[model samples]
Target: MNDSKLECLLIRIDNFSINRTEILLCIHFEISTQTMLSQSNLNLPGITQNVSKVLTIYTGGTIGMTLNENGVLAPVPGQFEPRIREDMNFHDPTYLPQEPEWLVLPSLGDEKRVLYKIKEYDPLLDSSNMERSDWKRIAQDINDEYKNYDGFVVLHGTDTLAFTSSALSFMLQNLGKPVMVTGSQIPIYQTRSDGKDNFVASLIVAGTYDIPEVCVVFNHKLLRGNRTVKVNCEALDAFNSPNYPPLATMGVSINLNEIYINRPPLIEPFSVQLSMDANVSLLRITPGMTLNQISGALSASVRGVVLQSFGAGNIPSNRDDLLTELKAAIARGVIIVNCTQCLGGSVADAYDASSEIFEMGVIFLGDITMEAAYTKLSYVLSKHAWSLQDKKDMMKTSLRGELTVKSAKLNTANRLGNVIVMEKILIQNSSVVNSAIEEAISFDQTKVIELLLKHGAQLTRPPLEVAESLCAAAARGSVKRLQSYQTAGVDLSLPDSSGRTALHMAALHNSVDVVKFLLNHVDDINQRDILGLTPLEYALRNQSTEVIMILNQAAKS
Candidate 1:
């Protein structure tokens, strides 16, 4: 091809207004060129081989919005694609060859080159206006192009991004490829915009990783779609998952939490269910909330209600009207799920204040985010074939990893045996062991310690003396055992023999959960050990990136 003809081909390839049919032809040309190059003996330098194609579905969000003549930011139809194509950050000048026949991105690490095409929606939507129909459209698009692309990206607005993400997670059943939902707090047209970074990172993650579930990518964090919530409207870091940890954190490199990413079922064919019941309501209870207010929320037409109740799902125990209203709602075939209003905690029936609500058949949401509860309830209720009881059962069961199962009750007989062993050990060495109970507690043998206390084992030692056991439990990464020790009145600030606190031990062992628990209970995070190393230093020494993040956040808090 002559220079002018080659330039025309490059311009056509870079044109974002072209339809999907034209993009497919460009892809075919690249494939044909690869075949011809392989058949001949010629080898091309700096040209990436084995490209991975990703489908970028621009559904309109803050990432694509620009300032109009009125100076208010709004979604400008047909603008996002062309902007990305012309941006230097996205289309590196070094990667654009003299011939410019194909568009290719730099390899993620040393993996296959990522090639992508944009499919913009006819009319862009602000995320606040996103509904079930829009979610179904996005899901259907992915389903139609499932086998043709390695992964997919959905550009969305941050306002209702979590809802869309959660809806898609349920809609895309048996998915075996990454589907990333991302948007920016600022428009890509702005000088200080976060759109380019979030967009590029989501593309790399979708094209590189084999994560087989819907996810939200924002502020350099990859979170499960159903678990995510929009926590901030103004900050750059806008979304968070309170109950669940992030699946990955992007820094100098993309650090993936492989253990948390869900794997697809073997031999299952991909499918999409676009239907969702829109009659669900989320009622957040406040101080002086009235029965009439609650009753109005659970109206006859509402199919499901996600009640964001007080701590541990407590309602107005003094108000019989509230209990009556909840019972009546359940009787009328309305599913009421009790989720905690607190940022982190589970809704349990352990408290007397919550007993009446539980007795009225209010289902415990068990540390699930409000986003997950609302979306899951809608998804479950959409099945017309399911009975009322079936819908309730599905809400309690985790279809995705949205909620965690409560821990099993401890075995009583085994506890008795452990208590006996501990009692003998305490009796055998009463004088030499200054704090036998403390030693037992440090090892996280809570059952033995509990039994010893029941049998009148002495716990008369000073609180500081029990610090060794706290450190031991932290090292073991036992949140429950650590809580038991904390409840037994151990001084969280006391240092062990080596002058290391529980925080240090948790950080050194890379126990992120334990470290988070200690941060709330511990007196000082900067307290150094014998070597003058704080918890942050220990985290760095052990190369625990997650622990380091926890400590840094705790320090800021």
Candidate 2:
């Protein structure tokens, strides 16, 4: 069958509650060709786009609220878009003739123009009231409209914004497009509110960048969604990613820290996992806390617990009863994840007091926030098909970049001159080699690359796809990295499956320095792609004047 028919079949299968044999029989008989044809012909969105279109899921938040009759800031549904229409910063009238309801934003200095439509929820929630069902609804909506939009923006309330972001990060798996969650401390209806800036920046980032991860864009900083926590209540900058670095910092120019951003998964198709087990709770250990409190938190219904331990994952030594209760819970199959109570730092056995807890089978999650820990446990435990041991193993793994694995060793090596630990990690897992190479290439870490090469780690070469290659990555504005590839004996003239070389990618991104560097190495400046376009043609299409000049000078030379 065709790609569209196969996609329709998957959707139909997902809608049914049938047995495996029945599903196989249905597929064998091809019983639904008429149904598939009708579904496929319903004006489904195609895969190509020239302009960016974003779907803003406006769930009720402080940004969309106004004073009700009681003079309290309450969410007023169906009123947000009208306010946006009045604000020139959000809506442009020039594109109204094309789509009356869709709001368009004028292109801002080299960024793609954004045309957005808002999907407002009925009886909008005050984020404090958001639940797991709400998270499932949002994830499902994004999946339902996945093909139509280039990216997504979720307008949420600051009260539980971190929880929502963390939940969505796990729900949306193998995401290829940007999904940005944003909110403001003040309402957009007010004159001096930060909502306008937050909302506008979110649309711009979602439209312009191909950041495949879920992110939170607040106060001009783009942070990974699962790593964020609300640090302040009244400040414009309310959220902070304490453990991870900002993906991009917005200033006079929006500077992207591309090394920290995750590339899309080249193998798996995008999917949404909406099943979340809500039978999880967080328990923070305090001084003089009784054993009954601990036992009460991990009651019969609770299947998982995120234990907030003392410094370095310690517990009170005198409380053997508390230990007994926790051990009993573990024996009863409760997954307990130990996290640090401090604002920063990982849960480790550095302290002698933490040794006993470590022996009790408590999983240590390094530097993960409480929000992430809770949601991760929920997501993991909800996998009913997986065995108990699988759930425990997954909690220790960094699936969505929520926690750092082996953080202590890496930090110690960086702080001190300890190369042995780093070398061991690199040797044990070849996957670390690719991440190491990416970092080295992006930051010009020559010594690090040399170390990896000395350890017998193979350098990644260009394959059929452009994104799969190091040269294409370098062409996005890293001349030093491109030189490193050339010095390492990599062939710079190899074209991707599309017959586009690094020079073509450099021309499209307007990387003048990269274009100049590749001119000396490439055999032909006039080499044409599968579309019969040269590097100069790509530069001309993007209006890249500097690259065009460099290519023209090279062509004549």
Candidate 3:
């Protein structure tokens, strides 16, 4: 359901400049959306002033409390999303209009109240009482209802809200939507409680932003769910987003932290995962938590353990039982990651006892929240029985930017290999990345082949080299310079280093030109890179998220 002419015209183009590459992008959308992937060009009008569009899911929580004549803190029927809409009607005319798609989910039935309107999912209430199945169910409903909308806002109780938020953060895999989980420090019935401002602000932010990563937008602060900790018990700014920056800070006018919002395309394919390795345990290293206790957790079929070390990731040097068990656990392939109990400080593997833990094969999660470390480790272990190599690789990589990676240089500071690879390539190609396609606009039809050939690029490599380049690009995220080698002129299928070719690199990087050149001159978008990676696989791995957003966008033209 794309209004193409309206959309293309909205981009300020009066006519289609049939480039060797652009024709492919246009064709990609026409075919993909017209066919199966359901992807389309989401070219929204540029906002001269702010307007909000949001989908609010009202899951029963303490945030909406109002007292009955009995004076109990109970949830009001449906004030979360609707209240904000009503408030905006009177006070702030500048407040953006939102296309409200609000759904009231089943409520919390405590000793005080028996609710009717609240739709109980599974009849099991407490968030700590939440199972992985419940997590998936909530996420599934959110996806089902809000996938087409701009952003999502969920009203949740603060008690175990972090768990559901964190689980949803990991569970929703590539959840490229703005989600704000907020409830009240006081119920809606309270005359002076903070729920109104918090609820209003959460919807305000959700309606205006498109942060793909899941975050808890509470009080006036935005927190990465996995990084968030409910520090304050009774303050207005009840939750603090310590490790990460707030996506937006609302004031006289909304100040958005564009740096934190999803940097790539929005309409991309996402496969949600609610499963986690349950064989994971957390060991809070208190003075009484013996080495025997540590050993026992490892012995309990725990494939991974997140060690909450004292202060700056310090474990008890005197505790031989724990050290021995930790070492033995490593030998047995159990991943031990040391995270700090302190909220602010980072984990140091360079210090005395801390440094020694490194030698025992314990991975250091510097400054990462224990929730992040635990959930991330569970994510890692659930994949495969990790080797020492895999363990080290997992620690080094960014699983949702949980840890800050240190590199030798500032510019080449590699974080997630696959994510950074082609993004960096785009930076390197900034001189011509867009211009290359832009220039192709004026070229004659026959000149497309000549211009592409003149650049010493090729259609595609043999499947083998296509695979290799895909790996290198996905891992390093930057392509080593293309070589005008002996086999440069051969069929696009010739596989190189990691079985990758030009097509593999192009699509993965969303190098529109490379993608276009391959389409116009090479064989097919359907062809795989060296490692059996398709253009789509490269898009997912490289997170060229929005590049080939219209799924069949690459293949058809």
Candidate 4:
């Protein structure tokens, strides 16, 4: 093909709307497919290979808006795509002319090309106008195209972006793909807009990585959607995950903090839960909050309330009327959750003023953002089939990495006060008793383990994991920790996930004291593992003569 003809075809593809019919017309040109593919002066070699598809859900945001006649910025539909297409940073016109549905982007040295299609919303809304209905719509759209795309990016206004992101985090259950929410404080049309970078980075991360989380990608940080809060109105980095770490950081390279990312559930199928009950409210407590004001905040129609309490979840303990109104709300089955008004720190019953509220059944979520608490309440309350207690329990737990769960037993251990008081607290929080027992045993806190056991906390976890815990204790030569578990009725002969007994770990780690202790408790001193190796053999292989001597003597006996 002639250079002029090739140039003509490239310009035609660039000018036209990306659709299949237009692509077919390009293919009908007299040149061969190979000839068309060879004309590449765009610095990308093999641009068609290693492609990832994303569905960009352009719900109206500051990024897509242009200034109106009144000089105020407003979202204008059908304007975003044209602007980005004109900017070569977002679209590469030379990529696969016969397949125009894929809006190809230039490779970012990661050897992956992102081909995206914009699904802009009609009658675009400022995120201030977004509600539960909007969250449901976005979630449902992602669900509908879940199979067709590698990931999703929702462009939204930064005003209520965190709330929308939080709602989507709950509504989109068992999400196995990245769903990134991002927007700019500045509009894309402006000369100094941050939208271009935010938009491009979101696309790259959503397409390139397997971070199975609902993330908010803005200002070079990928934050957990539910964990985020709009911290600053004027700054480019508007959102912050104060309690949690960002999932990925966009910089010289797209660096992912793999440990913080959620592993996609293998058992549960991806689902969209549209039934979010929006009849939830927030009550930020002040010093002089009257009974009538409290009652109005916890309205009759509201099913749940996120009480933004003072530092460390405190309330005016002297105000009997205030306490009475809160008690009345809880009595009527209102799921009241206590979240701190401070930017950082958890809502704890550390103060005397916080005690009455806790006794009255206000669930304390540690360091959870107000946006997350409110949306979580809505999500939990929407479950019509769940019992009242079950819904309340769900709120207390970190379902979507929303809160840092400070266990009741751990809290009690941190403040080792009167046994009677500790027992009362632990007894009431039975749901986390087993977990607390494990934590205590791991730390070799014998007294805490005993306290939990007295309250019916048992080693009732999955048998394989329990075995591993015992083996880990044995390997560390923590006789006290092992003794606590054994005294709590744990079978000393329990095998780990690898089918190796605690004796195997103790022998391999050269723990002579642990070896001696296990010899008296385990069913057999010479038990064979799944690999057909006995503890004596493991000790001999590891060349631990003391453990070897102990095993040899035990074998003789």
Candidate 5:
């Protein structure tokens, strides 16, 4: 049988609801044709012949749980695979990729194809019972199958999903493929379940994008694993990244924020670290806590401790016993890392209450989540080759974009030019006027516009003359400048003198990012310009492959 004939057979089976035996027979049959499958027939224009293969590691989670004999939801072994195989959405004959072949997504206009397999773990575990050994097993599994698949997905429980993701980010050094960890608040057996959507989105992202980081996908947002936290217990939107923005968002279309994603070094080889020290402890300080309570947490067996301090890494300076116990632990070679109790601020030594702890050799963790700090401490302590100071130094550095160093303010004057500076001087020296806002838009200074707005400058539509300049920014491929104007409340649908919107200008210049942004915000993408040309026509005329793909998807939606 040939590829086309096999596709035809699958389509017939799908339309008629044929027997499983026939589908199995067709899957087992060998193809002996030299005729290649063309991209046009598959509706994918730029994809290659090789299909992307994703390996899903299903470690017992709420996503696979079903009602057991006791009449309560539980992780039942050997049930998840059967459920997926029986569901039409997941196992439809037409949707199934030709054996070792590609399966196109109908919702995406058949632009991308994915081939995936599942590997379920034995003796399923609740997330609360997960330990360091389980993390080591998951890491080794990925390392063993690194060369066989394009990406990986781990279906995990929501409770410790963030910890597992953070552990994998450090364990899998120089990772080259996407490793997405996701699960659901509800089980798959229920009528109203989120598992199906979360799992399907994760598979698509893993197969298509080159994120190359440990990420958690939930409720349509893809977040970096190390930066994620379980924010809710009952809501479907369980995870959130408070300090960092999501790497991508899944909606009517997958919008990738490429600027924030961390790209690995191209020349480095992927490796896994299996040894993790489990001798770490975390302490959360409360008011009027006894010294014995604090000292007991730092037992002799513990090598590292993550101190959840009060407000900006502060300990009670008035209480000498608390400071003495911390200093005693440091003297005994215990590595104490200071993390903030708040959800979203960086730790600093500015407060007098926090100065004593800094003086006693407590390392500051800036904006590092508690989950990340705990796992990172264990990871670094397991490196027996590095010295004590080296381990402490690595804690402060950003391994896997977990932390960021405080830096000086940006030189806004140099980047924004003299027009912005003059506008600022005018605003600070006198009352705000409409001409300043117009000048800011003319000079492409978004910051100046924001400043004017902050100082009581009324946001009115720019005059007809500056509308041409708005389109000019789009043509120049300045997404940052365009975003500034959008932030300043400029109407996105305003037409230029030539009747061209920003989308038309972006399409003409082949500005892929700008085109995507405009498409997301523009009300009518099919609106024709004065020349009767839509953005799609402009993209087609310029042969902009990326722009055409985005616009085509938008048109389909």
Candidate 6:
């Protein structure tokens, strides 16, 4: 083919992705009967499919509910079971079918069809009424049913769904089976309800995908069950899996997004704790919160208090009276948990009054979300009337994946906790990597994103840490780390903590790939860092051709 024709074809394929029709013609350039017929279906909407082997467990939701005579859109008790038995059509689950499903795709001859039968289960409820007792029962039921099915689809109410999910992530432990919870805002019977897509996608997702953990499928998004929190009370996409990436997401095809899956041994067995013992209290400090209010909440027989501290865990510095009462509460065996008032900060016990409270006996909740604090504390407190050794174990350990252990900022760290401290460890541990900055330079493609992200760049993340990684990577001249940054979406043109991009860092050290990746991504060829030296200026002054080649490529791009 001529270059022009090939380019046109490439453009067309890019614009409208190469379907089987396009693929057949591009590869063979001949029309056959099968290819032509297959092409015909590509544009068709809503084709009823034959899901021959998958099981759809309908536990009731807006998907199976309708408006009663009183006009409330509610689950019609046993309606979910009949809907499945009546062959009421729906799409397959998000992931493909499983067995007791394994990680691999089904055998080629295995049914392109689904075998959905009405689960011979009991009635479903709107999740608002879901108590911890109900959660215990649901976990038990799913555990019992897991071995016999291809996958499970739970129709849950949007409200309180997060709580049930967090519970299941811990309760079920390591499920090789895919357990999915989903629901809709509008009733499935309503003309414009999002029920069909949400329900069908979750069903297909549960059956087809290999993420073997509890998850919530809603509004075309698949959230890791433990990490997710229902943020909106009324929207269709009500949940956000805070501090975690989605395990998978729904689209034309299910996109499984998990980078890793942590599982305990199934031989370990599924046992229900059934209770948590945390008598938690939340104290919201305003301009004039006095000792009286603090004493009232702490003295009210509460075993725990989530002291909502101000900036980085600060409070009124002069209010020794309130601080004294708080200390007394701590002496009363009250587990005071200090969480920052700022949405993004932590309680340092060094800032304002927050530190004094921390000194008084409050444990740092760090950046955990407020909804999580309430539910987790409630669940923990409910485990028993008293905080036992086991209850403390739950808090320190990440039960339900709610807390971070390693003290690093999230998404940037391969693990959690203390970004600065973590970076030094990641880099210093790079015996092969030699430096933290060299975190991702090994691969030409793929894992580069994860590596560079693990190395971390900045945007509101503290500068003291970035300076350390920057100095370390620059000192080592790690090519792999540089390349990884490109894939990880680092804006190469931007300045670092010391006012240098990798360009300037490369010029100082004469790194070829580092300079090359930087120049490729940075728009300004002659850009300078805070030191006012363009990378080219440094390359020329240093007289390194390798560094010069990198600068040239960056300039050309």
> Quick one: best TM-score, which candidate?
2
Best by lDDT, which number? 4
| Residue-level lDDT tens digits of model 5 in 57-154 | 99998999987899887898888876776676655335543442333333344545566678888878889889999999999999998866778999
Q: lDDT for each of the candidates?
A: 0.76, 0.79, 0.56, 0.81, 0.77, 0.58
Would you list the clashing residue pairs of candidate 2?
Answer: none
Ranking by TM-score: 2, 4, 5, 1, 3, 6
Question: By lDDT, is 4 or 6 better?
Answer: 4
Candidate 5 Cα RMSD after full superposition onto the native fold (Å): 14.8
lDDT digits (tens) for residues 207-315 of candidate 3: 5444667778776677777777778767767777566677677666667764354322123356666567788888888887755666667874888888889887788
lDDT of 4: 0.81
Give the per-residue lDDT of model 6 (tens digit) for 1-557. Answer: 45775665466456554466545444332122123223212222333442323345555555677778997776666665444433335423333333322222222244234334445235576666776677777776676665445566676777777777776666665465577887788877667877877766766666555556777888888877766777777777788865666767667666664433433311123445555444566887889976678777787588777777777777787887877777887676666676666645445656655656656666776656555565566667666654555655565565555665443532344333234544565566543222323322322233433543555532333444444344335434555444454455545455543345556657756666566555555677676543345778767765777777766765675
By summed lDDT, the worst window of 10 consecutive residues in model 5 runs over: 30-39
lDDT per residue for candidate 2 within 1-557, as digits (tens), equals 56785676667667766567655644542332233122213232331224577999999899998999999999876899888887788987765554577787965755556778999998798999999999999999999988777789999999899999999999999887789999899998899998988998899888777788899999999999999999999899899998888999998878998667765323245789999998998889999987678878989999999999997788887788888888888999999999988877788877777878788898888789889999999999999998999999999988887887754654444323345666787767656665555444444455666666676645564455423354446444767666766655566766654456788878877888888888888788888754456889878966889999999988888
lDDT of 1 by residue, 259-341 (tens): 46665312245788878999999888887887678888889999999999999888778878777777888899999999998
Off by over 4 Å in 5: 1-50, 95-107, 408-557
TM-score of candidate 6 against the unseen true structure: 0.57
TM-score of each: 0.65, 0.76, 0.60, 0.69, 0.66, 0.57
Worst 10 residues of 6 by lDDT: 30-39
Model 4 collision count: 0
Question: Judged by TM-score relative to the true structure, which candidate is superior, 1 or 4?
Answer: 4
Q: Model 2 residue 436 lDDT?
A: 57
Off by over 4 Å in 2: 1-50, 407-444, 455-557
lDDT of 4 by residue, 1-557 (tens): 67886776666567655566545544442242222233222234455456777899999979998889999989887888888878888888887665665577886775577889999899899989998888989999999998677789999999999999999999999887789999999998789988988999889888877777899999999999999999999999899998888888888887877546654312145788999897888889997867778888888998999999999899889989888878998999999999999988788988899988998899999889999999999999999999999999899887988887766455546235345665776767677777777555554556667777888888777777768668767765668767877877789888754457889889877888998898889878878754456899878866888999888888888
How displaced is residue 446 in candidate 1, in Å?
Answer: 21
What ranges in model 3 sit over 4 Å off?
A: 1-53, 68-126, 262-268, 384-392, 407-557
- Report each candidate's C-alpha RMSD, comma-separated, in the order given: 18.4, 8.5, 13.4, 15.9, 14.8, 17.9
**Full-model lDDT, candidate 5:** 0.77
